[model samples]
Structure formats: structure tokens, C-alpha cells
Target chain A: MTRYLRDIFFALAALTIFVAASPVQAQSNSGPLRIEITEGVIEPLPFAIPEFIAGSSRVEDAASDITRVIAADLAGTGLFREIPRSAHISPITSFDSPVQYSDWQAINAQALITGSVSMEGGQLVVRFRLFDVFSQEPLGSGLQFVGDPDSWRRMAHNVADQVYERITGEGGYFDSRVTFVAEEGPKNARLKRIAIMDYDGANVQFLTDSRSLVLAPRFSPDGQSILYTSYETGFPQIYLMDLGTVRARVLDSQDGFMSFAPRFSPNGRSVVYSLETGGNTDIYLMDIASGRRTRLTDSPSIETAPSFSPDGSQIVFESDRSGSQQLYIMSASGGEARRISRNAGRYGTPVWSPRGDLIAFTNQQGGRFHIGVMRTDGGEERLLTSSFLDEGPTWAPNGRVIMFTRETAGADGAPAIYSVDISGRNLQRVSTPGMASDPSWSPLLQ
Target chain B: MKLFSKLIGVVALLALTACGGGGYFGDSPISGAPGGEAAGSADPNSVAYFNQTIGDRVLFVVDEHTLTSQARATLDDQADWLLRNMEFNILVEGHADEQGTREYNLALGARRAASVQTYLISRGITSGRIRTVSYGKERPIEICSAESCYSQNRRAVSVISAGPGA
Candidate 1:
């Protein structure tokens, strides 16, 4: 099966090269035309990511580590194929000069990637460039990253994002971080802590010790901080952690209430979270700097999983007021809540799309859990994934893809992170160290 | 009407016992009512009395740790069966639906098991005789990907073990 997949991948690579070589097929020979990707069946774009050239850092770690990570990030999507290093007859060594088109074409590589790393200004400087192998020209200028050596994985993702954007004509999600709950130990005595890792599950640094149970760590829009709920003082409370200094402080240390399901607004100033009082969970927005809490929902029902619209004008949350968990949208300033999910089942975790057009949520009905999307006006609902257990749908910065947690059935089942495009074309499982869940995506780092 | 609602709530909530620990009625000669001979006949370590066909596993409300009346009733019988069979030891596995966060689900599962443990203790079952673990939503009794399956998945499963006796 692996060999067959590899051959099929090579064929697709050859096809991409052919398409790139064919001059832009003008529809009217006067203006740019839109090619119908076709209905019901859209082809996954084929591209080639050759092994990146090692930088001149002279690092003790394996030089191929950075390149391998970058390749894995792109290929993990099942959208792009990395041409086997053995297939390339001419190796790319420099990013300053143009690539040899004929050499790339010989191996059925449609696109070419070349990267270099060097120590500059006391920091690791990484530069990567993407090229259209057939067009024999650079797709975009070389991307340069400056960070410490400890963040080499992030540098790789940043480069992968650049490559992804250049080829797919869309933003890349590789340069993002995923904050999730990391669990350990046995079932009854399991210990969970909040941990942050690169989008591809690298550099897993726990933000809190397992001394307390934590859940739902979400990154701020600036990617400099995270807001989550922790059961530190015997009750769940909101806490904010700054990524720059690895320092954390309490957000709203209210007495005798559980605050959870925290997420940052688009502007990154105010954080919206759920406050449970008298067993009733309601959405509340709190200013991180001023520590002022404003009640957003006054219903007696369970309202959690609050997320902000892209423009921060409104909010979407899950409520059981209608007898089952469903998505509702209300103004950021708080008012009458409008139900946005008119689906056949219960919906929770209604995250507005970064494009502000749709809300992604977890829908339960018909004896299964599904990740679905619907318009903000309660129309055009579409189910993206169906599984024994699939929940917590967080969007990539571009709103092109959604990442969620999927677990198998039975007591010994393991939970893992999975990403699927909104179109449901690309589905890939991102393997973490152990059972992973509640994945929240960081905004684009660049 | 309020009194009737409270009565119904009491009946529904009777699935759980007020105590923290005790073995439910069974076939053994521990310390409880005498209809537990069926469980007493099995090996002390064997799970012979657990009936998969009965299908009365306890259920939990969304994000709630307290047991509902129906769930309490089910656990009441479970406790009775355990008390009658002194040789039986139980392991309560807590679970949650996929609707909530993973870690919170784990905590909620713990809360559910703790509730069950408290009920068993109150019913005269020894606390040491019952072991508890919370799988959160990582494990599901049902395989569907919808709300119905999730509702069923949110539960605590009690596995009963007994020794040969009586």
C-alpha cells in the first residue's frame, strides 16, 4: 500500500509540473478567468517539497531534523506530496539563485523548496524560498525567520506556511501553535495539565504542573498569551499565561464559581469565558488588563464554549436553553441571544470562522458526534466529520481548515488530534505523545 | 405540584444511595438483604454476576457530577447486589460525552465516580472494595458520531467482581 501510494504521489507530482508549465490558460484572453474547481469533486493540489538543504549553523543535532519537520507538516495534510529525495537527480544547495527547472521536471516535482539556516545576530536565522518548478520562477520571495535554536521547529512551520501560501493561493496554518490538555496516568487518577506545542506536535511545553486539572487553553490573537481554565484553588478559575516570559496570572479569581472554556477576542484585549454559578454556566467577557467582568448571557441554561466573531462585533456560544445544546450568537455588548444553529441535533462549541461567514461547532444527533459548520444567520449547515467522538473544532487562521479531537471507542481508546479542510477533502491525523484533546489553534505567527 | 415534582425527583434520584460505600445485595453472606445468592456463587475475583444484557448502566447529565434519580436507582440495586455478595469488588469507570473539553470531562468523570463511591459507602459497601477511574470521553459505550450516542457515552460503568461462596 505504501509503494502504491508513493507511485500515485509521484504521478500527481508530475501532473502538477505539467499544469505549471502550461501557460496560464486565459478564459477570454483579456481578463483573469476563474476555473470551476468542479462540483462534488475537487482535486487536491499536487506539489513537490524536496528535502530542505541544511543551514550553515554547524549544529550538533541531526541537520535533517528541520527539513524533515517542514516536509512532515506539508505532507501531513495529505494535500501536498514530498518527492522522495532519491528521485531528484540535481540537488538544490543555494536559495540565492534560481532552481534548474529541467532537473526538477525529470523527477516529476511540480514545485521546489530550498531552505538555509545560519546563526546571525546571535540568533538562528532561517530562510526558505518556494519555486514553481515548471514556470522556472520564484513563487514568492525568500522568507527569513529569526529566533532562538530552541524554536527551530517553529521556524520550520513558518517556512512551511510560506510554501503553503505560495502554492495553494491561501494562507498557511503551519506557522500556528496548538494549545491542548496533556493527560497522563491511569483512568481514575489521571492527571491533566495545559501544554502548548507547535502545530505539528513539537516542543511540547507544559504551562502548568499536573498539580491541578486544566482544560481548554486558547491562544490570544497575537500568539503571545493563552487563556484557559484551571482547577487550582478547588474550583475552576480562568488563568492567563504569557508565552514570552512563561509567566502566568489569574484572570478573574472569583469566589465559589467555575470559570472555563476561555477564548480570546480578535483584538486580544478582552477574553470571553464561561462562568458556572449555582450549576448554571453563562458566558462572560472580561478585560484582561482591567479585570472587569461583563455578563454576556443572563439565561438560566448552560451556556459555554463562547467564541468571538472575527471583527469582534458579536459572540457565538453553546446553550441548553432550548432543551439541548445549540449554537447562539449575540452582540459583544450583550443583549437578546439569537439561535444560529437550527440543525437537527444538539450543537456545542460554536467558533466563528475567521472569515466571519460561518460558525464551526460540534453537533450531536442521530446517535453520533459530528464536526459541522453553519452560517451565522442559521443557514447552510454542513457536517464535516463523523466519528464515535469528535469535538472541539478550532479554525486555522485562514478559516480554510478545522482541527479537532477524535477518539476511538472502548475504555483503552486513545484520543488524538485531527485536521480536516472545510471541504472535507483533506483529513490527516496529527499524532501527539499521548492522548490529546481540546486543540486550540494559535493565530498566524508572521 | 411542587411536592409531586419533588417526589418524582426523589424516585428518579433514588438510583443513587446517600451513603459513601457498601456492597449491594448479592448471593454472598456479607451484611445486607438476602437475595444476593447469585453473585455469591461466583469466584471472589470473577466478574460473573455482571450482566451485559441487563443494560442498566448509570447515566450522567451534561457536565454534572451528581447522580440523577434513575441513575441512583440503578446503583441502589447494584449496591444491594454487592452487599449480598461479600466477596465482590467493583471498579467504577467514569465517562463523559464528546460535548465538553477533554480535561474537564476527565474531572467530571471523577466527580461521577466519587458520587457513586459515596453512594456505595452509604449503602454499607466497604470503600476499599470499590475502585474508581475516569476515562473521560476517550472511551464510548456507543459507536455512533451523533448526540444520541454521546448521551449514552456520558456515563459511569460499574464492573462487579465476586468470589465463590455460600
Candidate 2:
């Protein structure tokens, strides 16, 4: 069974396709066709997707599901708005038929996506084409994907990803996964278990039981293993668990020290985390394979929540050295650091964006908490959401969105996962099983 | 009527007695009804006694790990008691109020627990006999948004168990 799964994973890893719609990887050079995404008000561009054409009766459900997922992916970005079918004048019936550009234009659909679903020898085949309706041209060549029927959502995401990239010039995060701590019971006795799910909170699979308290499950750079803090042995120590076998081994089990807040380097070769010894908490880096350790900060103050830059050259972390929790950037190797956050409130949980431009963090001031983002130099600081508690910001694969944990106040207060665009728009709650906190986004999957 | 029933429930629960230290205290142990095998506060070495009389925890201000005068007083008594009871190994669990980020709170809690450990070691308690862990803001003894609850929530508890020191 293991060998069979490894073989299938390899096929999916290659994203193998049996049908090649065309070998064209060129995009038409239309004038300023790409949406230059920035941190500001964006009018969600209008798009339309008709029901996918089904090649056979056995694949009707697959066709409709794929179309819906593709539409959902584009709409969830807050960058594109879907045009309902009721507003459409023409329904796409054949995959090869020419698009009724006039009909789509009548409804103000700037972009149109057309797809078809078919099955051959128990393999699901999906193909799609994106057209700039106003330009009356196919943005790029049509692409096809072939995979197991169980991976239908992934195929839909692939199609939507291509459409988004063709229109926005930005990478798509629809095909990624997120790992978080699923919670149960009350606030005081809340039981936590590590769970992994699709980006939209589907396919929830619990990695660990609620027996031991687990917090902050982060994905490795390769997304094949997870690093989190667990109380399995009555101490909060970081543990690495392989997703293949669902087995875990303690990464640091020092006899008297505690370890937590672990993050992977961009290359996935080493891990950086916080270690507490003699009551002094400082950041430490460990070579995962050799178990060798390096102390990055010898501060008498708190320094934790370390995140590596995209190039693995530097790390951004939180510290209270100057007397309050704030953000700082230092070299990946231990060295002098400079403070980055220059505001009235305390800043924490600094996460470097994948695009190497912005850092997201949690801000607290005037008795309220907020999820905010700033430039790499801590300039252009902007608060995204304000509530009782909004923290632990994780960046999406495209670096356009952020997901964090927002908690309520009072006796019956609870924590829920929420997300927003980096522009401080479209704040939406992400549904999970029961209460959840500490969300971490995975890199775009292969 | 809802508040009345809750008050009555609290009073009734405080009236029960047990030697174990799970749910046996509420402000003060009013259950010392001169009963059998209770190991009440009158018994110097019992956990029930340690929790009720000697005070097994120390509270802290928000974001501050420095021990207060009252906290130091409690640890002084705790160290004295722990020295007399050598078979009793204690696990120091540090906690925080739900006002900070999880990672920061965990680091803060570790500092708070380390403060308690330092005081106990100064009071001549062996480091091996005292183990420390931080729950961050995950567990709380009080559940409200006010300082009345936050003061109690931000605490370091020394839970005693009868075993050889690690």
C-alpha cells in the first residue's frame, strides 16, 4: 500500500497530464492587462464561469463540482467577483464552440473561463481555457490535467490558478493547505489537537489526538512534515511529525529547558525556535539532521516567534529587549539586531511574506488587538482587523492574504480563525471543527 | 435566578472535602468539618493542606515576571514546606492572562516560572525536585475579562506529587 501511494504521489507531484490541449506557454501582450495588486481598495473584477461541459453521463457530477470549485477559488480572493448564471444570456454547451463574447460583455464579465470534464479508464481528465472577454482573445493556451477522481478539487484549483495568474500576474494560493490546532471543550480546559485541512477548511484530518495539549502546528518548507509544541511528556517541547506515517519524534528534549515556537528555514534544512533556560527565553537555531544547535540571541529579555526570509538570508522575530514586545530583524546567523516596529502599541508574531516585501504581525494598543502588516523596514504600518484578540498571522502562498486567530471577550469568549486581504478589506471568518487558534498556511503544493 | 443558582452552586461545591487536590479549593477550604481521613490543612504535609494553607501558587501582574512581595512571601513558605517534605516533588506550571499573543505569552510564562524556580533555589530547594512548565494562556482558574480574573489567571502553581525528585 505504501509503494502504491508513493507511486501515485509521484504522478500527482509531476502533475502528469495525458491530454495536451496545446504546448503554448505564451501570453498575449495586451496593454496593462495584469492587475497590479497593492494595499488599497480594489474593485473585484467581474468574471463568469458557465457550468462545465460533461463528456459523459458518468462524469456530470464531476463536471459541476469542478466548475463550482473553480468559481469559488476565484471569488474567495476578493479580487474577482463571479457573475451568476441567471444574469448570463448564453450557456456554454460545447467545449470546442467559440465563446459568445458579446453575451459575456452584455453582463460586464471582463473575464470568462470555460472548462470540460471527462473520464477515461477511471482517470479524471480536466481542461480549461481563459479568455479576456473585453479584449476578445484567449489569454493563454488551453491546459489539460489528468489525475485520480479523488483529486478533483486539486485539478479545479490548478485551472483557477492559471486563470488568476494570467489575469493578475500573481501566483495563486488556491491549491495550498493550512495546519492548525483544532480545539474542543471550554476555554479553561480546552483540548487541542493538530489538524490539517484544505485552504478552504475542507478535508479536515486530525494529526494528533486531544490527549496532550498541542499549540501552533506549522508546516515544514516541503509540506511533508509538521513542527509543533506538545505536552505529551509533561513539558512543552517542539516535535516533528512526518505526514506520511503520522509519527512524531521530539526535536528538543533537553533535561531542564523548554522549547516552543518552532519555524522552518526557507531551505527546510534547519529550524529556529525559542528556548527557555534559567528563566531567560532566547531564539535558537538547530540543524535538523545533525541535532547541532546555535544560540542566536543571548538577551536577558524575551525573543521569539522567529520567521525566515524567502532567501534564507535573514529572520524577523519579536522581542521585548527595549522594554515592550516589538519586532526586530537580524541575520540568520547570530548577530546584532535593529528594532523594526516604531509605534505606540506592542507588536508580536512577525511573519515575513513569501514575496519578500511585507511582514505581518499582531498589534495591541488602547485595550484592543489588531492584525497588521508593515513594510520590511516597518514603514507603512496598517492595521487590518481590530477586536478583543487577533493574533498569530500566517501568510497565504501568494502573500496577498493573511489568516490569523481572533478571540472574543468575557465569560463565554472563544477563539476563531479569520482572514483578510493585506489591504485591510474583506475580513471573513474561516470555519473549522469546533474552536481553533494558531493557523499556519502551507506553501503552494506540487 | 440564574445568578442565584450559580451562587448556591458555588457554596455547595465549597462544602465538599477530599484529600486530592483536583477540585477541592474555592478561595478558602470551608470543608474542614472535623471529618475522617480528610488530611485537612491541619496536616502539614498533605496537598490539601499545601493548597489551602501554605498557598501552592503565586500571582503576577500583566506582562511582568518579577516576583512581588506577596509572591515572595508565599514562595518563602513553600520553600520551607518543600524542604521539610523531601519525598514531595513539585511541578511548577506558569500561566498568563489571555491578553497577549500565544508565542509571547508562552515566553512570558516561562520567565514567570523561572522566577519562581530562582526563588525556590535561593531558598535552598534542589533544582531536581522542582520541574517547571508554562501553559501560556491555555488554562485559567478564572474566566472573565476583568483584572479580578486576570490577577488569578496569571499565576505559577506548584503542584505536589509524592515521588522521587527527577
Candidate 3:
């Protein structure tokens, strides 16, 4: 958070809608520039990012690196197609260069992003501008970020996020990270450890060794610590690790009970998870500061995988109360829960989207596994992926995409992380150190 | 989600200089023939004999923790063998198929192990003689994606160890 943003302009909310007159007229008689995302409504917005101009030779490497990170961030969304440099007729050779609307329009680029990187006051400084190519005007005021050299990637992410928010009206998720189980070895003897990486799968760092098995690593709301289940003592218990020291301590230890599937309350003061005592598994909530625990469910059926709503008022979770696994929602204070999964095969690993509009889950039907989403009230169910095993769905910070574990079939079957847009398109694998699973995304870094 | 629990055998393992024993102890081959034809499983009091002749594991259907009649029959023999081998301790490892979510499967496996332990206790075995641990869907004897493999995979294996004093 040491990076400083300067030249903040209180620009008027005036966005000119781009392309497709049908929705354009309906959305903007004369409103701000915007792109309303929908299924089959329009084509991908073609945009171009010529190599950001570097002010000095000292920052040449950083200039290119920042450009690559920003381009990858925007293009990876599948909403904006990056027009290759070869297709560009005009190059942003200088930060103060005048607009060449005809040159950009000739290449069919509807939007253009330009920037320059330099050093100032012993810090890496970056400046960027967004433009509506045909409109021939800057979409918003020019912005600049000043940070240490080591933080250039974050500055790039910040620039990309601003461009994204201006066009899509939604906060960007590029500046986030994901914590997951990085696995090694064969399936039967798979050694797993917790690892964290940049949102786009860059800069992976292992937090634990594979000597013990770890599963379901989740970032705390503030992104400073992680909560996961580990078999450190040959039994499953919840462990909370402070990322600063890379050390962990068990959260709640009872002699004979197994606890796992822990998730932070959005406020970060409480946690909800499943605890097994005797043969029954039930949900439990603990006040993190006081270590006071209360049972949220009391049943012979298994109830686990509790996820908090964005507002922290309610929780969505999986249970087998009806003789089969399904999803249910209950109050954050713990009371009667109502089943929300209507169409059944079997559902579990229910994760509430950060947007608070949908709950994503792993659904098993017809012997195939699926990562699907449904409205909070259990309407408009849509399956986004199908495979031999697609489990543990985690949402992107923006809630427009989900990442989950997709393991192939057979003796050598291994798990890898994959993500898909909520529209059931743009499915792709997220690279990790080795095999990985159970990804939980962190909120945008402060 | 859960893993190997050697809690009941700490003392036994400590005394043996810790070989950790093969997890495949239940599937040992009958190595010899008539009288002493097979050096393995020849002595009734031997660990191999208990595993090969008395049976060491029972399979369950998908998502079900309840023991079937055949599973109960195998437990009966297992309980009888345990009574004869009074100096031995048992670890019941429950496993599940890969068809369910990780946490759900872990809990299911725990229930299966508990069911077997409760049944053994009903047959006069002390709770101290048996400890239960769920491998969940982590350890599978067979790895095929088909039901043939999954059926055998959903199993509870009674692993025996000589007690600390032995």
C-alpha cells in the first residue's frame, strides 16, 4: 500500500457507449462510456497497448514488463481482445503525442491504452491514459502511480484495473492472489502443501512443506493470513498461518475431534467450519479473538463447507440431511437452515460469490462432475464445467469467474486448477508449481 | 481430507524401531503350500495368517456407511481373530470413492470406520483395542474410474499391530 496514486481527477461520469446501436441507445442517451456485458450481445472489444514508452534506459526493462502484465490482465478477461502490435498503424512513441484516431481506427481498434514508465524521487513512476478510439477523446483523465521498483507489477495491475472499471463499471480483480494446495507425488501418495500466487498464476510461493497433507487453503479477508486444514499430527485440524512469518498454529484443538473446511467470516473476527466428533459431522462457528465456539448444526448427517455471504449476514454450505449431499443456507448466528439446491444429483463445496448474487458449487450428475452457479434463492442454475472430477469452486474477486480442481481419471489421475467465466466460456487452466487444488482467492490487495 | 492415524500403535511402533509396516498388509499372499508349503499364513497366530485367512477388509456401496451382511460376516471373523490374538491392536482405516466432494467424502469415510469399530465393540472387543481413521478418498486400492474399481475402493481395512509389550 506504499504505492501512491497522484493526479486524481474528479471527472464527470460521462462515458460514451461503444458499438452496437441497439443496446447503446438504450443504455446511453448521453451517459458515461460503458460496455454492458451479456451473452451474445456484442463482439469482443478490440483494443491495443503498444509497448509503453520508457522515459529513460534505466527503466527499459520495467517498462516492457509492466506493459506485458497489463496487457495480459486485460486480454485474459476475454472481454477485450488485444490487437497485436503488428496490427497497429500508430505507435505511442511519446507520452505527450497527439491522438491519431484515424491510424487506430484503421486497425479496427475500438479502444486504446497508452502509458509511459520512468523513475522519480527514487521510485518507479507509471502514467497511463485510456481512450475511445472512434470518439477521439480520452475516456477518463490521465492517471499516474509512484512505487518502489519491486512493486512495478502492482502498479501495472492498478493501471489495468482503472481502465477496466472505467469501461465495464465493475472493479477489476487483477490485483488479487489465490491460495491453494500445491501437490506432488502419485495419487495414492500425493504429497500436498499450501501455496499462494498472483491472480494470474505468477510469483508462486510455497507456505508449507509436503511432509504433511494440507487441503482447502483460504485467504483471510485482509489477505494477511491463511486458514487451512492440515494432517500435521496425523489428524485433520484447522490451522491459521500468518503470512508474515510463514508460521502456523492450530486454531481449536480438542483431543479426538476432526475439523476441516474452515472459512473466515467476511469481517474476519469469526470462522465457520465442520467438526467431526464420534461419527457425526456438523458445522461450528468460533469467535476468533475469544476462541469461543458454538455449534451451528446438530445432526447425524454431514454438514460442512461453510461460506459466508459478502455482508456476513448468512452462510451457504453443503450438507447431507436428506440422505444425500446438497446445499443449504442459514443465518450467520446459527439457526434453522433451508435447503437451496433444487435439482439434485449431489451438491457440495458451495462457495458464495463475492458479488453476493450467486453461490457456486460442485455438482455431481450422471457420473460427471460440474462446477455450477445459482442465484442466492436457488434460481437460474447454470453448470459452467464438466469433467471426471471438477470440485472445489472458488470465485474470482469480481465474481465473474470461478477456479476449481479438475482431476482426470485413472491410476495416474492428477488434479490441476482451472477457471471459467460465469458465462460458461473462456475456460482455461491456471498454472501452479505442480499439481494443485482447492483454490481460494483473496480480495484485492490494499 | 484426513490421513493416516497410528495413534493406537505409538507404543507398539516405538518398540519395533518403526518399520511403519506396509499399508498393503491386508493383501499379503499365501506364500507356501500344504502344512508348511506356504511359509506365510502357515501359523494361525501370525499376522499374515490373520490377514490372509481371516480377511482384513470389507467393501461398502457408494455413499453408504452401513455395513452389509457380508461385511458383518467378515467382522465376525475379524473379532474372533482379535479375541485369540489378545496381544494385538487394530487400526480401522476407512476409505471412500472419488465420486464425492473432498470434505463430504472424508466425513463419510469416518462414519464407515466408526460403524466397523462399533460393530467390533458389540462383539466384546474393548475400545482400547481399536482406533479408527479415515483416509477419505485419498488411498484407493484400485484406480480405475469405473464402478469395478470404485466398489473395491470404498472399503474399511482392519490393520493389526502387535501391542507395545509384545
Q: Kindly list the per-residue Cα lDDT of model 3 for residues B22-113, writing each as its tens digit.
A: 23322111211113223457778776566667667888988899999999998998898888888777777778998888999889988998
Residues A234-334, model 1: lDDT tens digits: 44578998776667888877764557778898999999987755445678899877889999888766677889999989998877788667778889988
Identify the candidate with maximal DockQ: 2
Tens digits of per-residue lDDT for model 3, A1-446? 11212111112122223232112232221233466655532466788998999989999999999999999998888788899999888778888777698999999888788888998778888888877777766776777777767777778888899888878877788888899999887765677889888888887888898877788999889888899998786667899998766789998778657788999999988889989887789999999888999999998899999999999999999988987899999999888999999996999999999999999999999999999999999999999899999999998888888999999998889899998889888789988878989999988877
Model 2 / residue A236 / CA error / Å: 0.6
lDDT of 1 at A44: 36
Evaluate candidate 1 and give its CAPRI docking class based on DockQ: incorrect
Give the B-chain TM-score of model 3: 0.78
- Order of models, best lDDT first: 2, 3, 1
DockQ per candidate: 0.05, 0.44, 0.36
Chain A only TM-scores, each candidate in turn: 0.85, 0.95, 0.92
Best by TM-score: 2
iRMS of each prediction: 9.4, 4.3, 3.6
DockQ, cand. 2 = 0.44
Name the candidate, 1 or 2, with the larger lDDT value: 2
Better of 1 and 2 by DockQ: 2
Enumerate residue pairs that collide in model 3.
A14-A32, A15-A32, A15-A33, A16-A33, B32-B37, B32-B38, B33-B37, B33-B38
| Order by TM-score, highest first | 2, 3, 1
